[model samples]
Target: MITGDALLLRPWREADAAELVRVQRGDAALRRWTGAAVDDEAAALAWIAGQARGWETGDRLGFAVVAADARNCAAEEGELLGHIALKDVLSGDGRAEVGYWTAARARGRGVAPRALTALTGWAFGRGLTRLELLHEMDNTASCRVALKSGYERAGVLPAAPPEFPLDGCLHACRPGA
Candidate 1:
């Protein structure tokens, strides 16, 4: 597990399925960004299982963000601050696209930036030279997080927003590269 000052970055576990579904179900923002929550237990199980398989094969890096403890602003274990991960990683490219979100209840608390910084550290430690963060333009909060986490606005994509009504902005960053 990768430890941040106030959060825990760890692999998705089988037991997290039920609680994960419950946590995201009623949050419209999360559903818009992450897609509808799994309404059925079996589906949730399948989703978590797929995440496990992907991680084992190095196809994806999924980390659950949990509060350090009661004193931390983040949620407790069964609860999640959100998720941060690198996707579409290409071998020999030294680059990957990053995506992340904070649980609705955890928003406005600087959790996302902290999570991004932690993921940046982890990715750099693994030799990744470049990291990209993308978010719909409507998500100014995400934009702020990326900027605060040290990413520079690389460019914007028109009509890239799937759920939210906005364009998409791409931010790029690297660690000592």
Candidate 2:
């Protein structure tokens, strides 16, 4: 688990399924940006299971961001603030891609940047030399989070239609950068 001043980041659990479903179902922006479709409990469980598998395989690392004040509470009692992850990890190359989304109620609270900054520090401490953050060009909020978390704009990524229909910004970070 990662503990920050106002946030706690821990592995996702099966018990979080219902809350995940509710959040995803209610947040259209999240669904559009993440392409997440957890319309039911079953789907949410499957999504959580995938996160577990990612841990086992070491190719991805996801965390459930919760309010720090709820640290002593049970997983179900904690407020689910958001999700952040390091995906497409290439351990041998010391690199990975970072992604995240904040709960609607958590927006404007610095949730994404705080969680992302903590995660980035942890990743570097674990020997990851580089981290990449990508988001659709229109997602100015994510762009701000990336910049705030110390990721510098690297380049522009061409659009991949059907899935990513707009040009995207590519940001990168390295230790002390």
Per-residue lDDT tens digits of candidate 1, residues 1-177? 777767888888878877778767788888777675777677778877877886887867878887775454443363577888888665668889898878888899888999899889989998899998888878888889999999999999787434645778999998863
Off by over 4 Å in 2: 70-77
At residue 109, candidate 2 shows an lDDT of 94
The candidate scoring highest on TM-score is: 2
The C-alpha lDDT values of all candidates are 0.81, 0.91
**Total backbone collisions for each predicted model:** 0, 0
Please tell me which predicted candidate would have the highest lDDT against the true structure: 2
lDDT of 2 by residue, 1-177 (tens): 887767889999999998898788878899889998899999999999999999999899999998877545344346899999999885689999999998898999999999999999999999999999999999999999999999999999999998999999999999999
Find the 10 residues in a row with the least total lDDT in model 1: 70-79
TM-score of each prediction: 0.88, 0.95
